[model samples]
Target: MQTPPSRAPNADQIDLRQVFGTLRRYAPWLLLTPALAAGGAYLLSRQQPPVYEASASVIAVDNDAQNSLINNTLVTAPPLPQGAVEQVMHSRSVLNSVVGRLQKTDLDPALVRGIARDLTEELADNAFTRFKVRARLDPQQRGVYELRARAETPQAAQRLAEAGVESLIAWDNNRAKQGVIRSRQSLQEQLADLTARIAATPPSSLERQSLIAARGQVLQNLSQMAVLETAASGTLVLVAEPVAPRAPVSPRPLRNAALAGLLALFLSAAGALLSDSLRRRVNGPEDLLPLGLPLLGQLPLLRRKNLGQGFVAASHSGPLYESVGFLRINVQSLLQEGKHRRLVVSSAYPGEGKSSVTAALAESLGASGLRVLVVDADLRRPTQLKVWSPDRLATHPLPGTDPALPPATTVSEMFLRPEAAHATRVSPHVDLLPAGTPARGGLPGILNQATFRALLDRWAQGYDYVLIDSPPMLSLPDTLAVAPSTDGVLLVVEGAKTRLADVERTLENARVANVRVLGIVVNKLARVGSAYYSYGYGSEQASPPANPNLRATRV
Candidate 1:
């Protein structure tokens, strides 16, 4: 048969099962936040306006050809320059006209539902100009300028693009006409003056020849300017007309929802795991492994209020009874070789089920026909009397029942004393020594007395086993004071409630006091699964007393 695991778990070792179990335990919280986040993202997406885009292109005049035809004069300038095209397209006056035209169109209510009214007012005043329109030269075709516009609806975007294209053409034509007309008027005046000056000079004179040549050159220049002025009103021509887009470019609900949900899930799980790690509480056997003690047994969570009462009185014959029996066997196996029959049951704090476990253990041992004496050593807050009623003790005739019972050693004589008058036999083979009313001397005074150790020795000589119920180690020094004389200490840890640091501190205290720790009893396991309820160490068959002979040896 394989022995129980002797060494504690490595504190640094990672266990995948532990991770799964933690996730299972906190599944509700993990699921809730991510769902909420995803829902919120989807709703926010729905509230946003959809954006549509449309593009238009225009042909720009070649600067080199236009300038050469105009004789490169400052007055006869090129009709269009690439650098100035973008600036003129987005200029304040040009954009204002486009915005005014857009505001007049009947925009669809469903497309721009939330902000349509505000958008109309802002566009009329040219206030919503950010990224609404852009102008740039086409990369594939030189001298071709492209106009792009975005709006709440496809029709609105198309209209904005067309308006920008038309506005730039109108501005370019008006500017070109003014410059050409002014240059032509100035040249006509100069040509008339040269004609008058040549008429006044004689045909044979040197000045007369110079005047005629200048006049001829002026007329030739006038002819060229007149031809250039009538060529075209504007340098730019339409290449591609703006069309309504097929789809909106933004407000992707599915993608946003999925990303938000994943982010929320990661944050929630991380926070829960971090909090659990920092607390480091004993949740089950997995946590208790760090204590380096044999897991004698794991007790199920008991619902009965009087679990501290005798197991026989409670009529509990389920796994709880079997588990208690299991603990008794392992404890016997450990102590059978030594003369130390005393066992101290305690925990790190009050309400850890230490008192109830002590009572049940004694009752389980007695059921196997062993003479067991249970002492309530927690004088500060005694509970054994409430557990095993003192009234039950009165019903049993201690010495009258046993034929070989020592006459001088009555139950009352052995337990009833000036300090403890309430001790009595509550059941057959089992006795109770209640911690009576608080004495004039406190718990420290009572446990520290020489009589306490002497009394323990006398009881050991008479009873097969002596189980003492003591106060929590951290709560009071009573258990520590009584630990040195006991055979061994059994620490009781409540699952998911008792902190690991408290258990370690209690163990260190026992160590300093020279008390041998037998093992650990994990109580209040919340799981109702078969793994927690079933016994794993030994045969399911309940064994009879290995030694039926009940005579106690004198020390």
Candidate 2:
């Protein structure tokens, strides 16, 4: 026999279909997170107090008289850089003056008191830390500055902005008058020294006469310096006055809510991806492709109420029945050319519905006019009796068996006494040998390799196909022990509940035991879109008649 080609490993790669499946499962949580975040942001924004802003504009230029004095080399002073205008406006002196003006006002007394206290404390710690009054220069027009102030009310904001402008102007004027004031002080000192020297000298000396002449020149220079000082005006000129604003600049609820919603959405998507990676499980058929096992069929998840009945293929007639029919066809095709007759059905763990799948497959095969036999091999926990109701079994005993003698009822009793064993008909063409009574303590001691294989050969001769329902392979050694005797094993896995690691471990155990795995049957899948099995026929309609031309082939 030729082996199937090996597929490349895709454990490290991400599948988009799997990602979409994960997102669909957690759709409600993803939608709820962003809404809650946006609502929280909106409420927080509304709680904040409103703040009003008012601005005043000014222009900086050189004082005409002072510029002339420096040009003529009569006074030496460094020119103020354009960039320093902002620094000057925010200086401690200017802010202190603004604070003083606020104290004298009667408008918004509570606001005035708060501003006065905060500014005083902030300035003492660091001059640059004070931010009540802000200064910014116009980028397009050089030497043009805008002074802004923020307060609790419109009237207080306007008052603070106007005070800041006046204080800056006064400071600039004082800086310009420094040169003239210094020159005047020097002339007055010279005049006073000449007078003292004349008083101290003899009444008629040439030195006194020269000193008197110098004193008159010094006094005349002092008078001219005073006139120059009076002519000097400040460089700063007011361009726009502050006015009360109509709207507040802060507490924008809509914009804040929008920003919060976007941030929350990104975080939720990333979290979903990370969580799916950590807790990876089977979501669809694509998740099983990495195991390198040929897929047999996919069965839709049945309602909880139908699970207790257990035989979905016989009792239900919608998607489950159609899907079982497809599974039966695939199994017959695989075993048609080989000498394989008996097969063991099992899963990685218990409660995966492996027993139910066995009962349904047997019923479907029997419906095709082939005699099928189902043996419940799981002695510890038998479920076939529950699946096929006890009342449905035929009362007639097997042919050629003595009616007066007692027949072996359970699989364990059959293994002990093969000659006395007998089978009971469950359906028209199907027979069931249930695991009569569950073994106490552990597995029955009669399950020997040679005895179990001999009994299977005897039971399989009367039927075309034999299905043995074994226990979970990973949980106990009974499945693996009985698996080597069967032709092959059928692996059953539940959708969205079985983990990938568990499936891999189960496959490894089967390989080590030298068991042939037929294929994987993904069961209990959620019917969503084309990912799961769905038939167009409605459940209310009668079952479609089977085609008479189709013939059952045997190996």
Best by TM-score: 2
Query: How well does candidate 1 score on lDDT at residue 322?
Result: 58
For candidate 2, write residues 1-555 as lDDT tens digits.
111222433889876766777777778878888889999999999999988889888776544354765544333223455556667656678778888888787777788878777667766766543244334444433366777878888888888888878888778777778989988888888888899999998879999898889999998888778777876556578999999999988778888898888888778877987887687787667777788877776777777555443453333467777667667887887778644378789999998889888877887888888888888988888888777664434533443445566787678766666666778666677788888788875436444577777667767776888899988989887787887887789999987778888899999999998888988888887753232334454253655343232221110
- Candidate 1 lDDT, 294-351, residue by residue in tens: 8776776765553444434432466676567667888888788655488999999998
Per-model TM-score on C-alpha atoms:
0.54, 0.63
Off by over 4 Å in 2: 1-18, 60-91, 107-110, 120-143, 201-213, 216-224, 227-236, 281-463, 466-489, 492-499, 505-555
Off by over 4 Å in 1: 1-269, 283-291, 302-316, 338-340, 389-422, 436-445, 459-461, 526-555
Query: Against the unseen true structure, what C-alpha lDDT does each candidate score?
Result: 0.69, 0.73
